[model samples]
Target: MLRGLIASGRLLANRATTQPARLSRNLVTAAGPTSRCSLPHTHHHHPVAAVPALARGMKVRSSVKTMCDGCAVVKRKGRVYVICSKNAKHKQRQG
Candidate 1:
């Protein structure tokens, strides 16, 4: 019983009185991928010279027609697609 009490006392005496401040890890760097994007890469692990503005996607929607000048509504495989050849960001799909 005396040994147990001494060991508990020793453990309490060795502990730090104050906790250390936590580090702030929310720093954003310009060199990070979020700041700048590299060239479009293919699934084959090959980097392409450029990502075509009109990337084929099945999610093109009809409302995206006025988003770009090169937008065109295309029908493929019984589905509707809004394809923008000039700007790939405007691509949308209609259900």
Candidate 2:
């Protein structure tokens, strides 16, 4: 039983070392800018009010079409506006 346990432990240690090298290589290639699999940079500018709503446990709605129960509303510069939902004056700004 002791021999079996020692063999298993050695096998596990060898396997762990080999796996990390393979994973690290893949990560380096994928993260490189020249790699075809690399994702495009996306700049998302969130409204100023999103910070307070996130702290208060409100989930950000994905679409403007969804009706919010007054939770996602924000007041900025004397104007009350819905952060996620589309208003009558302006189209919904896609993040």
Ten residues in sequence with the least summed lDDT for candidate 2: 86-95
True lDDT of residue 51, candidate 2: 40
Q: Write the residue-wise lDDT of candidate 1 on 10-65 in tens digits.
A: 77766543222111122233346366444467667556588567645555444445
What RMSD, rounded to one decimal, does every model reach?
Answer: 17.3, 17.1
Which segments of model 2 are wrong by more than 4 Å?
A: 33-95
Clashing pairs in 1: 59-92, 59-93, 60-92, 60-93, 61-92, 61-93
Model 2 residue 35 lDDT score: 58
Report the Cα lDDT for candidate 1: 0.62
Leading candidate by TM-score? 1
Model 2, 17-86: lDDT tens per residue? 9999998788777778465555577888876765443322233335433354432555567544455433
Instruction: Write down the TM-score of every candidate.
Output: 0.36, 0.31
